[model samples]
Target: MSETETCDLFVIGGGINGAGIARDAAGRGLKVVLCEKGDLAEGTSSRSGKLVHGGLRYLEYYEFRLVREALIEREVLLKSAPHIIWPMRFVLPHSPSDRPAWLVRLGLFLYDHLGGRRKLPGTRTLNLLRDPEGTPILDQYTRGFEYSDCWVDDARLVALNAVGAAEKGATVLTRSPAVSARRENGLWTITTRNSITGETRSFRAKCIANCAGPWVSDIINRVAGSNSSRNVRLVKGSHIIVPKFWAGSNAYLVQNTDKRVIFINPYEGDKALIGTTDIPWEGRAEDVAAEEKEIDYLLAAVNRYFKEKLRRSDVITSFSGVRPLFDDGKGNPSAVTRDYVFDLDETGGAPLLNVFGGKITTFRELAERGMQRLAHVFPNMGGNWTEHATLPGGEIPNADYESFANTLRDAYPWASRKLVHHYGRLYGARTKDVIGAAKSLADLGRHFGGNLYEAEVRYLVAREWALEANDILYRRTKHYLHLTDAEREAFADWFAGERLAA
Candidate 1:
């Protein structure tokens, strides 16, 4: 709280990697400061495919190490954040032209045995012609495989890590950007400017971490005035949201003729989330969106398999994100490795850790190993402990979400079943904090269509660093998917007026 403050670690970028490192470092008894350019997870973190999965297709590229590490992380992350993450079965309808049945079985076998899987169910053969999951599919696809993967509330996962870091004594600053940093006299002098107030602040950090995702290289060259031999490939991926068509809880995985796979997963209770095309992108990461051609391609892929034909009009909303993949010199964008690399510059006595490429599943191990790279500097820092820790609101008995849901119903018996579900799934053990002492529908305040209530919005603003209306409607919660356009406009107007009066 001065012109210049000093800390053990200073982290730039408030995405999952940055927040995760901050939490891990702080919990290890190290002083930490984390700053973000925008709201937490406002970047690619919130706009991801939202699956905590091991890249099943990576087997073709011989990335067994990455797949194994990711597979192991699935159960660890699920236990750590049970409320926001849970297992979902994916039904991959077999396509003979794309891959042989024996090859598929071999991949599935490796997926089952390669990792330390304890909780998630293994892959099973499905009869597409006889099973209800296949009722919507064409008769040609008679045999399929159903496998397990975890779904995550990607945006909330970032927020929870930030909150956990703050609780562990880290200075968490939202709407703050690290404009510049320089190493001098074995310390980093970093300047951060608050975007909201236009106020500049400076700090002295023992070490600095660059987790800027798509902006990783810019941070190295422009902010730190340093260079890394490693580079990040900005491949863009896009997803679209449509009304839920099928009856089961299982998600569908379709193999396109292009040999790329697309996921159609259940989203926000009543909708289906479909996605993803890997196209080489030259545009700015922030400007990426679902192009018209990508949308048609996705629709066509789904239309080829399911009885429920989707049109362009059926797509309610779509988003895109640029993956900061480490350049492996592969010609194909999809063939690029999802593995991560770290560069430590300790030449000036002050260390600068540059995180190159990483996925959500591997962030924990990445942080642990990253800290190990700097062990020579801080010999007294604690050992790795995040493998057994619970994230905020993830303290359920044995990470049992269903048992916890039942308990939530017992506690909030007066609340509607749907309302209880919204709170339970989002807040978990912390549901009481959102519900407070409300005992009836009147205490929930105004209803803004669907389950978007004034109480939940207020909770997010007061506790979760929610500033803009879109922060509450889109990122922190998926209320936009269920609300009409008129309702969303009204909510935005109301939010604007409230902020002005404040």
Candidate 2:
């Protein structure tokens, strides 16, 4: 490589934490460079529970600090990206066989008041037989409690952070992996190879941040050749998507006999997203997939409370992510801490910060604190500004999405309700840019299937760094759920042809 380019900071892993850190650091006027082995959020960040929630169950683990910080972040993230993150109410039906009702109530009480509760409503007891929110539950359950959290577009959250970082003058290299790094003469020299173009590049950075999520240690040991006492426990989490079974928009949190809670949330307007089983994983992080037993476990948990029984055949799609948890010597995989830990190795004058264990709910705070760890290196960098700033296209007035959706309807009454909703919910204030001069649906060009319009695909490709068909189908949008196999094949073929032509 011809003399490595120098930067103030170099970040590995383009997941949420890395992206958030890059955005914050770049906005401080620092020369930043961020690289990811795969696409942005191609790791555990995109394959999450998709909730900006303060892991309610973490209360059992006595993670008061983590829960409180995440709770406070709920509203902050909502304000920052209202189009992608919104409030969600979870109905926890009381099961006498599990924890006592008072215990559940106490947990909810602490959860409601533990953080600065604003915008979202407090928890409320519900009569399962009478309350509309409890209609989906079986008659055996007589009481319930509804508490608030926020839902997030996990993939988009990472993308927005990267976009914000890029706009703030950060060099973000997707599909590029940090091959190696070494500290020399008070600066860290890092080499990266583009996975697509096979181009090798090097940079000299004053500081290095490893936010590789599941690959934190891989980056630390294999790439940076550094050591840290802090270790990561890889706990595999899996989720399954199925057709909507419940009547209301509210989500259900049914406790299993084993004390694990399963979330059945409304997803993509018509479908339902159910997930997450925690099991210790030993396989490669890239090869982790939802096993048959996991799918069964999820179905059994949901079947215990819901009136409608879900079976193996009900599963439409499934995904799995390995949580790079900070190993606190906890025996149970679920008992491990979801909170992040930073290891700053300033052994050779140049500093290396390695992060392990973090959730989507606490990414911003993690980034802020990560920066504070390196404050001595960049003493003159700008002050913290992310907490009060809106993400790209999230400049919706007062962060009110409903009002903006209404405005979109008035402007494009000719557009179908679903199409209007798709744009408003995804783009927010930037929906106009996606819809450009054309007033009618015809101007959107070809329609592949569902809401997969040609204009949106082009925009994702040219602007959002969408390279492959799955990037658009599954991550950028959940059009895979609506499109038939033939339709998907056609879209993929068209996308490949367009790329080849370009």
Candidate 3:
């Protein structure tokens, strides 16, 4: 028989929302068990457009409340995780054929003032022909607007939240699926089976939070045998990665003929990430992939604004994710609400909180509110505290990453600047913990190409719940993007050997 544990909260997902909720609940003195069937953020959470901004276009749909909350949360998130989230300037080259200049200006104005703007710079008008940001843009776009937002390593954000939850006395079970959940004796009995180790564990939880994202409905019906009146509308969004053609550090936001806006952002060290088409999807989330037409559509959108045209051959890679939006009877997938909905099913005294329709930008706020909804059920849980708290590795003094980067370089003067910068951005104050007492590059152990070393890999496996090579290469870090084909294969082979030996 598998060992059974008692917990105050049982969260049935490991995506951003579920991880965030687990962290918040644990911080409030609740014993939480967060279970995931795969690596953290291996699904939709890692495949975001990588921005922590108030959805600028959501304003066009008159979603003022949603926009305002996201804007406010943007500031809070930036303050919380400056290491992985920082201010980014987006240049929107005005195309009179798409949206009028006045309308764009109006939206920018509201975006600046909608939430209490702090730390981040406000919007500004620009002469596209004169500004450095306009150099790569076509001459036809004479005027433009530059606005502020923040970029995030989406996968790392989810991991840090899970780490925070664990630090606060929460059990984070990765690759463990909740196979059975039933309401019994005013409590919930949840059983989880480890897919990798063939180990089974059960928990007696007072409440359950169904933050299963796209699988939210499935968990309610299949696992818990509980039904929800709410449903998720799966919207597929795709992105393509290409070699960075532009010279500036800034990102671009352009309008397509279909009235949808596409973002072309500077990604990694030398890549540009262009994305996202909102198409209604009736397929499984795991089966989502970027179609050929979607790639061409993104390239065509970019060609419309830039002087240098992109070819389909220039696309290095493409990925797709399903946005589990709440069904609001809206026919247009783009018009679906980015806001979240919570259905608290308090049947038979054991409550089930089902979350639906939330974006990465508003996850913290969503988690905070979801916990507040169960305040009566947990009459003694702590009050809201994540609002101003720093995430793991984000404890830099004053949340200043650049200053911390310089300080880190000084600390490890023997390390290359690129290595220092990589660790600084990814791990921040925790870089020392990853590197240990290593004095030089040679002391860092086997180098599997790029800045990846044995030290960091060991730390991730030991502390960050990294299990397989994909979890380390794809989700926890982006080492696969920089490593060559042969190098990646060799690393994977070596990782398998190491796991078997362990």
Best by lDDT: 3
Task: Please provide, for model 2 over 213-299, each residue's C-alpha lDDT reduced to its tens digit, 9 standing for 90 to 100.
Answer: 888888888888888888889999999999999887789888998888889999998889998899998889999999999999999
lDDT of 3 at 188: 99
CA lDDT of 63 in candidate 3? 99
Clashes found in each candidate (C-alpha, N, C closer than 3 A): 0, 0, 0
lDDT of each: 0.90, 0.91, 0.95
- Which scores better on lDDT, 1 or 3? 3
* Worst window of 10 by summed lDDT in candidate 2: 432-441
The Cα RMSD in angstroms, rounded to one decimal, for candidate 3 relative to the true structure is 0.7
Candidate 3 lDDT score relative to the true structure:
0.95
Candidate 2 off by > 4 Å: 1-3
After superposition of all CA atoms, the RMSD between model 1 and the true structure is 1.2
* Candidate maximizing TM-score: 3
